[model samples]
Target: MTAHDTATAARVRALVAEELPRLVGIRRDLHMHPEIGYEEYRTSQVVVRELSDAGVAYAAGLAGGTGVLAHLPGEGARAVALRADMDALPIVERSGREWASRTPGRMHACGHDGHTAILIGTARVLARLAAERTLPHPITLVFQPAEEGGGGGKRMVDEGALDGRHFGPPVDRAFALHGWPDLPLGEVGTRRGAMMAASDRFEVHVSGTGAHAAWPHRSADPVVCAAAIVTALQSIVARNVDPLDAAVVSVTVMQAGEAMNVIPDRALLRGTYRSLSEETRSMLERRMTEVAEGVARAHGCTARCECIRGYPVTVNDDGAVAQFEQVARATLGDARVRTIAAPVMGGEDFAFFGPHASACYWALGLARPGIGCPALHAPDFDFADEALPTGVELMCRLALA
Candidate 1:
């Protein structure tokens, strides 16, 4: 690194160290009071308060009344945007931490608490740099709501969160990060192509005649038909989709008979399908409906399939990925950056930013050596406090890049 660059990196680190204490407090506060999608009122307040204290400009009460957009002005023509999700999952906290979620059936199991804290730190540090006039371009801060299936990222883009309507300039490129449990702490990872799968949900309703459990010939059992439909649905991935391609069809919810002895007149089946490519996604939807209907007909029942499209495939722009690698290595050191081996099957609403700007989403490592962390969305999962400084430093340097 050049002398100027080295000095700048050092300054950023020192600033992060200065801010860590308060940021950690804010993160713990968020963890203790978790909120679900479109309901992050308290979390939204924390973000706005932090931005206000830093003298950063922002707009609140957005994206279903919980989104916040903060900005920093610069000399560049178009702004660069950074984002963090502000929603928690619906799982009960079982992490056993002293600061575990106080609200029952809600927790920040996805490390969104950490992401929000890092972005807050980034805003604070960069606001200081902007005061010193060291900024290279306009920076956008997007605190989005409802990332856990509420389409808050899409809502933010639709509401002009990145278009500079409330900020410095129209955003040209965007970046986001998620805390990853598999990678060792202090590392950051990304790839040039697809980073996450496109998620789609399905519900199947099967209609059949009700009958007594003891009378086999007296009824057309809907439960049996629903089970058959579920079994045949698996073939959509195993037999229909190409082995080279990746697809998932899971029947997660099933409801039919309530009584032990009586067969219900109808059955309901709900599940999700995920694919990495649009072609595969389209095919999965088509074949899923076809399989359910085809299987139900042969079982003396009628079926209706409803497919709901969720988040699109998260694709990383080549140029954005390159810039992320460069800035991450420069800020965190060369060995701390990793090129991920493959795209994960999970879904991310951050994919919503792809159409508006050159967007890149990466992973922040959170696991300790020889001790694996809890999987995301698990009851025991919690954000790693020790990794906060690394996340903050990367985001701060990315803003200056």
Candidate 2:
């Protein structure tokens, strides 16, 4: 490694060490009052307060109502954008911690609170660099809201968050990180290609003539048709799609008859579709429609299907991933940065930024020593405080590099 890069990495490590206490406090505060999706009003206010106090130039309410975009200008035109989601999930707190969520039925189970804190820490470090005239390139800090389900990333893009105004000449690279409980503490997991799947929701409505249960011949039971459609839809993944390719078609909700003695006239079924490729998504959609319609026709009923597309596949740029690997190796040594073999089926709205510029997303380990880590979206899930320094250093290095 060059002497300059070594000095820069050492500076980032020192900055992270200095900011660790404040970063932990911010994360705990966010954990105490968790908000869901597009309703991150109070969360956005806290971010604004922190950035304003740091004397960083920023734009509040950039995307819709909850997103905040802050810019730290440097000496060169080459710019980098760093993103952190600012939304919580609807899960009761069960972490048994002193600083657990005070609000009932909402918690930061997905580590978004931690993500936000790390980004804020990065901001503090970069602000210092800017003040000292040591920053090499501009950095864009994106505090995006509604990453849970509101597609706030897309909203920010629509509102010109990534336009050249924020980053000087548009972002040459974008970086983001999620807290991962499965990996060891201070470790980072990344890949060069698809790291997450595309998410899509579908609803099927089955219609038939209603009648009494005693006169079975007279009624075309919609519940029976819905059941058949559900069974057939499962085969689309097993029989139609390639065995080597990954796909998931789950029927999560089923609503039909209310009365015991009468057959319902309509039945509604809803679920989600997950795939790694656009071709797989299209194939699943077509096969699902065919299965619903064919099953209804066979049962003397009519069926209609509606598919709502969600986030797209998260594809990491090869060049950006290489840069991140270099930074990780330099900061944490060679053993901490490793390739992830399996791609997760979960979806992320950060995929929205992939179409605009080079993107690289990685996972920050949060598991505590001798303690079992909790899965995301669970009631007991909590962000580990020990990983705060690691996250802050990673972000600072990515930005300064």
Residue 33 lDDT (model 1): 94
CA RMSD, predictions in order: 1.6, 1.2
Model 1 lDDT per residue over 117-188, tens place = 999999999998778765888999999999999999999999998787887889989999999999999999
Candidate that would win on lDDT: 1
Q: What's the alpha carbon RMSD for model 1?
A: 1.6
All candidates: TM-score: 0.96, 0.97
Pairs that collide, model 2 = none
lDDT of 2 by residue, 244-321 (tens): 889999999999999999998999999999999999999999999988998999999999999999999999999999
Which candidate number has the best TM-score?
2
Lowest lDDT block of 10, candidate 1: 128-137
Candidate 2 achieves a global lDDT of 0.90
Give the residue spans of candidate 1 off by over 4 A. Answer: 1-3
